[model samples]
Target: MSAAALPAKPARTPTTPSARLAWLDALRGIGALAVVAEHLLPWFLPGLRPYWFNLGIYGILVFFLVSGYIIPTSLERHGDVRAFWISRFFRLYPLYLAVIVVMLALAWWVPVREAVPRDGSSVAAHATMLLDVVSVGGVADTMWTLSYEMVFYLLVTALFLTRGHERSGLLSMVFAAAAVVVGLVSSGAVLAGGWPAYVSCAVFVVALAGVVLGRFRTAAACVLGLMAVVLLLMSSRVPWLGVAVLAVMFAGTAIHRWERGTGRLWPVAVTTALVAISPLWAIESGWWWVQADVWITTIVLAGATFAGGMALRGRRLPRVLVWFGLISYSLYLVHHPLLKYFVQISGDLRRAEVPYQLGMAALAVALILGVSALSYRYVERPMQALGRRVSRRYRGGLQRGGDTGVAGQGAGDHGVLGHEEGQVPDRVRDHVAQVDPLR
Candidate 1:
């Protein structure tokens, strides 16, 4: 559910400062806090442990919805599938690769390495970061979400390149309905574990082809289509929850399309309703179950929080919340491994005293925050700037080289989803005009 950066910045044209996307930052901050709190609070405040009302689910779902709402705009901003991929690559991979290296180094000294499945094949599969579709365990507990995020990217690109992007609402509804059906009958088994490495490797190669081979538009589109199909069909470590999550993301894209004038609000509303009601379907379908009343209460509360956030989207949040939003991605990525390491290191402290437990938990959280802040500054932010620059260069090269394809040509790259070809409404245009752009 984490994002590397916000959409590319827009040309500065001053407007009402308070009527912007600080609420989105606040939402991210809240989700980050909820997740972090879910992890940390249990260590010190064991009485608050309630699996049925897991705050982690709430936070992650919020993050997912936000991604659905905003991510498509980035594709439209670049107007080139290849450019978008390049931007995403620079935005996401460098830091991810860095973390992987760090984790591998830690394996030399700590038993933490065993947390991930150990095998040559499994290691190769994870190196691709599409482990969900490939049906492999993650290097860390949270890395599984990255695979789903990758699938969303592939699907969005597939739809956009195929000119079916405007039908996002319809597709979201279909996915939700299908998910309900699948939930009722599907065993949620792994598709096939035998060739996961090969399939994952092929997808990676084809994805690169789709990005770089602009002249072969038909082939690229076909590759994208195949990629999307494979992603949706493959097994997930989380089973039916993965399918449900995709539906929610598509619902978000539907809302973005409505705001862009490419689709209608009613369809968005309907699809969103489906996504909101999915947990009940999930529990009833026997895919998973929690305490009914408690789970229902948590779901309702999560929806209310989401609705409230959307209603107040135009309002600016406090500086601290905005700051938290800025560092949330880094926080999400780094916290779990740190938590695991400390939980072991401080085993004796857990039995020592209540005060020690509180102190230890607080200290762990503070250390995580401190490390996350530094990582955001050194890793995420620089890479984001580099991504923007690389995207621009790639687009410029395509223009100069006269390889204008489905992505659109220079100057002709009108904002297809917006009012004018190149012009977006201020609401969408103001997407990147913030102190720290919400990702």
Candidate 2:
């Protein structure tokens, strides 16, 4: 959901982590616009859409890589499981729920996508943010990516708890291998129907509650990690793709490790190659984007983008790009639904004159950006403020010697997530600021 770099040395004071992180924001901004263009071009300028590579996939891959790079590091730095979950909830859910509510309201003007099942399980799946895996369509189309984001969070939490987090490179390769095996053997969802959604939802709620409440924490994390893997393999709409995506994320973590001097780059190289070809033998029909050539191109470009961002991590990126990154989550989640309604009201722009279509597209972008800025200002900021307060209070209680060491360090040693604006440590602030607008 966010991107970060590990500082080689800790600063005595919180210098300018933001400046160092501008490149990641640049990447987030570019990814957001790329995704917007992917949806917009088809509707208003079909002639501009490329056949060689998929813009939407490329943008999301960038996002997933960014998330992989930052999320686990953020968790490890925070060290407090409760505070980590609290921050995540505050950072992601408020805007996510608001978008879902708005989409449901917009359904009166534009019918909900037929991919969504008219069943209560859809509600359950949404609650868990496991919609894609459970084969329940999201209210908003882009919500599929959030399922993977949630899975990564759960897996990282478990790995951190058990001291297995350092094996990211190995984990990345394992998932990549799983993707290859799954692609060879499976064509579609094997654990089909609403039951997976319902059951997973129940398990997610129980495990998350236990973890956050600090009750049987290790057991809860293990259950969640195991459940995440099981769902990816058996319940996902495309099993190979799910594992492949996880491989991409962990590969991002591997890169972060390499940069930080704790790991090698070989696993990252292997992960990239495996993920690029994961869908080559996939038996699915009708998805032209996943054809061997196109899929390979998408992976290569995403990797290149991440590499570019990493290379520029110390430079000042364009302000416009950074601003777009600030509002990306809202833009990403709300734009598709807004576009649907825009089309419903304006009639099909695809059939309109080219100039008129272009004009309409410009207006749509303005509207989406305006709405996203408002959502960020009014929804995300205040919720994050509240999360900080709650985390501080909860953490205060745990500091009374209840906190124990893990992997030879105090679990609550690091302060992340809810640091008051200027008080944030330089090593951690860039990660927190990026969390300001999750992908």
Candidate 3:
């Protein structure tokens, strides 16, 4: 059928279970926890460790994969490019802005004897999410990842707006690939000139991975395997490649379903064994490869763990982790600045001994959790609701103007409500339309 002549989707039943994509939530939670562990590494161990076992880095790969999987789904479901952008802005911007503002306030007000010197340029770049582009020192080291995320958001938004037509997907893929080649070639030169070259390279790798996986599902698995080998070889030269590799693997895994049986145990066992051995090897040899191995093993373990969790779909656990997943983004953005502030406030305590450092780390985590919960409950949730309402109204207006397309469907369908596949009831469609007057 011609695209314009396609019929509207039939309304799903209201009594049907809601689609809740818990896997994404669980993955997000895992990412957040990995970041927390990465930050707390120094406190837990002696000396200034590079924090290579840092699951947080791999968690970003998961983030990218999750976004790739969900954005297309959102476009398919919502059918409105404007609404998708609106929802994304609502979901990400408020918390991001709030974190920036809070960080600024702390930087301005907090007194510290040994504060990292803040450059005006750096502050501006970070506040605008243009730190990587501007080559400014980030307000927080972790903010580097946010720069890549912002770029990815823009690219994905473009793809969503174009609705996979105009060969926009192909165009995006080409651009992303070009970016990687350029970044890798220019990174060393840029660094020699005193710029943060790794940031560009990292962002390009992420974008390239997204494009490759989004475009070629069958090759996705092979690409991931190849990237893993490259990452292992280049761990010291381009540590970020390791992250890209993990991301590719995660994306590949998400695209394919492995048979559920006792046979899954072998890979899980090997992955677990590798993860367990990695840290020990890292501590003993102080080799970067050991560190890389640790992260790779962790990513494998995380994948296995996610599979296991999915297997336990219906059973209710403590849900504390799931709750953490809900606020994971906020937690991640806010954690570093909060940690910096804590270090400043408790400098003397931190320097006391290993036990004291550990204690401070615990206290920092508690504060982050508390602050993130409040941010989610009061700030993020309300903004999200407002964004959805605005998107619905805007799209509804478009529909009334005779724009009868799938874009009339609300953004909630694209995994925003954390719904899973096969869970969206036909009846719920009517309810959504009645309630929002836009879906």
Candidate 4:
């Protein structure tokens, strides 16, 4: 794969300041449905489980790639670290905490996996959402992905603060190479057993907190290096999967950089090919990735899907799908728990006939969508408005506290989509990302 094979970039449009990126919304919509289908079909209608296509993993990797692509754009588009966190906090936590309550209540009735980490550490680690990378059992199995997402956030923020975000392509290449080499040489290594994982997790959390708290900039770099090194070395349950996931995410970020014209397409192509093929080395000579019947199929399909989306950037998509994208975060959160509870309450999932189970799955998706639409309307939208309001007040208030942000008004926002936030939170909604509403 090379730059020559990639699709031509779309022309930039002259639009209003508040213009929405429909392509990302469309991508998120399709990806969210794929995830819902993947989870439901396999769980209920086991007879129809396709051995060849890994819809769940495919959906999730699309999410990771989209997150990688859009998150950095959101961050740099506003160029205010505080405001970015505010948007993320309101965007994610309101729905996340609500889902937690639902998950816990459902667990009481439905008999979900309640595997907590030893010694109550799971509580603290999960409170921060760094459990899996820190080697703690997640509250939900789906949550494992969030750990990698959080780490990616830290790494990107560090790069931006250190004025190195423009080099994301090189970094993506480095992560991909590490994935290949590490996967090939050995399975992988965890940092330390037991308490050390917790301790390191705590340290990283505190450092991140400090950085987000508008403290010294050095704290940002410190936490970034510490967490990155630890994550690179820590593989725990799976072998090179962590590295591979990170590589995939960074590959997204790399593509984003190229799309914005600060980077070359060649590195992005190289990184994607590396990420698509990296798993071959990680799969023990005999075993294969749980996501795929054939690993290459997963990579090829994902690449094609993304490239196709890129090629048709300005095209119009169905209204239903775009609306689904609007409520994707709520859908992603509540769908799993509702489905799990439905199974538990129904009792004897395996005993149900394929036709009956398929009907139930469809109903579950319908219910999830209805509830998600309401959640998005009543919950996410209002909270997001509050977040933006809070962002405005927070940035203005920082001046009173004598905390000059990462950079002052005069600094030109330099990287991809980076802008001079002279007003800080200028067109703050630009930072609102519909992709990977994984929160």
The per-prediction CA RMSD against the true structure, in angstroms, equals 8.8, 7.1, 13.8, 7.3
lDDT of candidate 3 at residue 298, scale 0 to 100: 50
lDDT of 3 by residue, 1-439 (tens): 0111112222333322222455556666776776666555544333544444444445654554455445545554665545655666677667777766666676566532121235443444544353434444344445545544444344444444344322322332333333334334432112322233334344434543543224432243234333323322232122223223223332322232122111222332332333333333221224342345664555555455555444444345447767777788677767766766766666534246777677766788899899988988888778878887776667766556543347345545533553211110010011101121111
Reference-based lDDT, residue 294, model 2: 84
All models: lDDT? 0.59, 0.76, 0.46, 0.62
When summed lDDT is taken over every stretch of 10 residues in candidate 3, the lowest stretch is 423-432
Model 3: CA > 4 A from native:
1-19, 44-52, 109-128, 161-184, 188-295, 309-317, 348-358, 400-404, 411-439
| Displacement of the residue 10 alpha carbon in candidate 4, Å | 2.3
lDDT of 4 by residue, 300-388 (tens): 66666766667756666677866766677777777766766666666545558778887777777788898988988888878877776
Q: What is residue 141's positional error in candidate 2, in angstroms? A: 0.8
Which run of 10 residues does model 2 get worst, by summed lDDT?
422-431
Comparing candidate 1 with candidate 4, which one achieves the higher lDDT? 4
- lDDT comparison, 1 vs 3, better candidate: 1
Model 1, 1-439: lDDT tens digits are: 1111122223344544344456656677777887777666555555554556657667766677767776666566555777666656765676667767787789765544333556665666666667666666556545667776777777777777677776777877787676666555544444756366556667666665755657565456657556655555555543455676777677767766654567655654555455545545552333222345544455455555655666565555678876777677777777777776777676534345777777888898899899989987888778777766665666667756654344433432321111100000010001111111101
Query: How much is 234 displaced in model 4, in angstroms?
Result: 1.9
Model 3 Cα RMSD, Å?
13.8
Clashing pairs in 2: none
Sorted by lDDT, highest first, which candidate order results? Answer: 2, 4, 1, 3
Quote the lDDT for 59 in model 2: 85
Report the Cα lDDT for candidate 3.
0.46
Error of 1 at 372 (Å): 0.4
